[model samples]
Target: MEGMALNQLFGNAYFGRKVLVTGHTGFKGSWLCLWLTSLGAHVTGLALAPNTEPAHWSLLGLDEVHDLRVDLRDGQAMRQALQEVQPELVFHLAAQPLVRRSYRESLLTFDTNVLGLVHLLEAIRETPSVHAVVNATTDKVYAEQVIKNGYPEDHPLGGHDPYSTSKACAELVSDCYRKSFFFDGGPRTATARAGNVIGGGDWSEDRLVPDLVRAASTGSILQLRNPAAIRPWQHVLEPLSGYLRLGQALLAGEPVEGAWNFGPASDATLPVHALVSQIQAQWPGLRSEYLPGPHPHEAGVLQLNCAKAARELAWRPVWSAEDTIRHTIDWYRAYYASSRLLSSEDLQDYVAAAHNAGLEWAA
Candidate 1:
């Protein structure tokens, strides 16, 4: 929290404080836990176990993450977990986050993403000690809102698919909670809308970055349903850092509320082919080819304007696509290097090195 203002960073370290992370066992959740540990935060995770093969969280040895495995849909269990933790800072990332899979299970998607968030908010309302609640929402929360060039904070809340609509619905719930409950006498509440996240350890299906890594690892051709689709591509650490920074702000009791977009700067937005090409160049030895395949309906061109984050929070992305792809690929290739074994400590060190190597999301 060195770069953060004194108004923020009031509770930077979790030395004796309680920090609860829902979805701590997923790819992004694992990274959040890693960052929180580095910050010395007393963290507890509540979410379903990793469902993907070659498990990302287990791979990082987060099985000992002081984490409890429970579906977010279980209101009683979720509430009990909240009561037990009594966390001061809550990062709610627990939900059905996949779009393609959501097509297969729309009910679960709606139930988990929308209703699950409601449960967390309800628990926060009942439980004391909840100083700040950073609800994780997707950029898709905007209703059919690509907004031509960049989407600002004022963009309409919307989603095209069940997963996106569910996220939009979650945002709607967050708005309701913020206005109705977490207002004058309620806890400081804010929502984070992030782009299509990519990082080292993710192996989930439907996501292009993870799919490419997995295919490369197994010596297979990569398939892309929407090769021309564009996204506000940023490394996993970028927005995670922003979340921490924002949590710091909220805990300090600063007058910051409502939705904020954590994404790369304008130049960081790239199309699927450009992104894949960057990764391919970084991993020359990996066998890969692009073959068309069926995929869920996704935005053709999506972009975000992080001006609100930059103007108010002074947070911005430090890494460009070239460097992000290089570092991301390096983490995987080096981890699986035949000459040496990568330990948990090695992975942590690598993540730190990546963060420190360049301003990558540091402003």
Candidate 2:
């Protein structure tokens, strides 16, 4: 998928569109920015400066993006940025995204994840240029039921940790704004709940793939707190495709304003140890050591049923667990061996895979 074919994705809804992306400095946000720009969307990124050294946003060197370093918690700043951008499409991905860090900085997590979203939505309510909005949440928004079949879109929203609870609150905030303000003829709003997203360029703290990369690059033994924890994992592009498809639906005046899950197939769900083993198989130097200790409360098992996305959006993950691990390891291997970026290549490969799978968006 390239050139005309790439632009044809999502019915070419993104082409020539003015798009606003919050948290564009973060991992997933950077990837979304790259993909949106590739589809010919004029992107304006609104978020704080990149917090980490060697940030993906800087590495991508996307000079065309109108980058604005504005804090989401600042309502005035959010309003000013939205007013200036007057974006036709919006993707909100900013938040305190870590569970353990949330326990340490619970107040900051709530203020950023919950209140930050309020600021964005309030701004969107006032700025009429925005025709569609997708608020990216997490799979942990569902209460811990440990269900084998996986949590559906209607699963009761609850969270044991601050990060999860705050995202759940964000989901509620989106719903409130949608009904209270945008119910009649306003920006079509929806929420996206994605599972554990692993790919290149995600060097965020406390995440599994990044931690493994750190240990492997430094030749240190990786620590595993909950090796048996099961999570529905997929490449970063999987849920992003779902989000883009959902946005396409909204932009086309289709009725897709609601919560949707973007996760891998049931067979791809695996334990932390299993994922670690797969990564180790790909990179022989990677090693791990299980640690026995009292750790922060994290979900032991979580899965998502993406039937709604499949039925309505015609979205399904194109990569399997093996493909995900292999591509992830290959990416880090290329980056560490030489200063190289595989993001664009990976995106093209993913689009091609989706095209091969007969996905409508790729078609």
Candidate 3:
């Protein structure tokens, strides 16, 4: 989509608006910053420096973004950053995102995911310029269950590990702040629970796609744990679209201050082994070996019902699971083989596809 056409998206809420995206140095956060800037939004990013060497944030070279290396645990610093930027819209994505790492750094995960959100909300409360906030949680927030369909928004919030538990706690924190503080005269807020997001530029440790990329690039056998585990998988752009749509509603003063699920269709929820096979089909010569026990606890099967987003927000996933995997693998291949960045190309293709699908936000 062109600049004017992209600006017309989400009812022009983002065009020329001052937006704050926490965790802008991370994989998903960098994508969000790129999209927001494409829509002509003035973006201020607040988060710690990128931990990875080939960090996507640095690769993008988004000079327009006001990148501030502020740790979310510091309440005073967060408050000061908010006061300085005075963004009208906020998307909170900063957190200790790894599940396995959370086991070793339980306290750090809790501090960053739970208390970090508290600090941001407190800062939002103090900063009067903010109007709408989208707190990005994860699908693991739902308690373990044996339901066949999928977990809805009303499912009980619970977690088995520190990372999941911290996010669930963050959900609760968002609720407490939304109801307790963001009332009659306060900024509107909502929580977004999305499925397992896979895309290029996500070189995070212990994740499936990055692991596959590393193994494939190094000509090593990929180790697999919980091969039967299933998750609601979608491209990174899928949930970012949902977040932007939700932000559009909140900015429009719509009554959408509650939790919502942004996930793929039911059939897209595939097991770990099956997803691996699909990716191997796209890229030949990818070998793997299943690792036995001694692995940390992870959800076996998890899915999400996005009926609420479709019915109310008129939002839906533009690409199918096959499309998502293909785009993701192609991106990594281009990056490694020829040092080409397909992020901008992927964004344009995704927007065109969404517009073709008649999604409300894209239209």
State which candidate has the highest lDDT: 3
Question: Tens-digit lDDT track for model 1 on 13-69?
Answer: 444567899998888888888767655678899988788876667766654468798
TM-scores for all candidates: the values are 0.89, 0.99, 0.99
lDDT of 3 by residue, 221-274 (tens): 999988899998999999999999999999888889999999986667999999
Error of 2 at 303 (Å): 0.2
Error of 1 at 174 (Å): 0.5
Which regions of candidate 3 fall more than 4 Å away from where they truly are?
none
lDDT of 2 at 192: 99
Q: What is the lDDT of residue 158 in candidate 3?
A: 97
lDDT of 2 by residue, 1-363 (tens): 776567778888899999999999999999999999899899999888988877889999999999999998999999999999999999999888999999999999999999999999989988989899999999999988977678999989999999999999999999999999999999999999999999998888899999999999999999999999999989999999999999999999998999999999666799999999989989888889999989999999999988899898889999999989888889888988997999999999999999999999998
Model 3 weakest lDDT span, ten residues long? 1-10
- Clash pairs (backbone) in predicted model 3: none
The total of clashing pairs for model 1 equals: 7
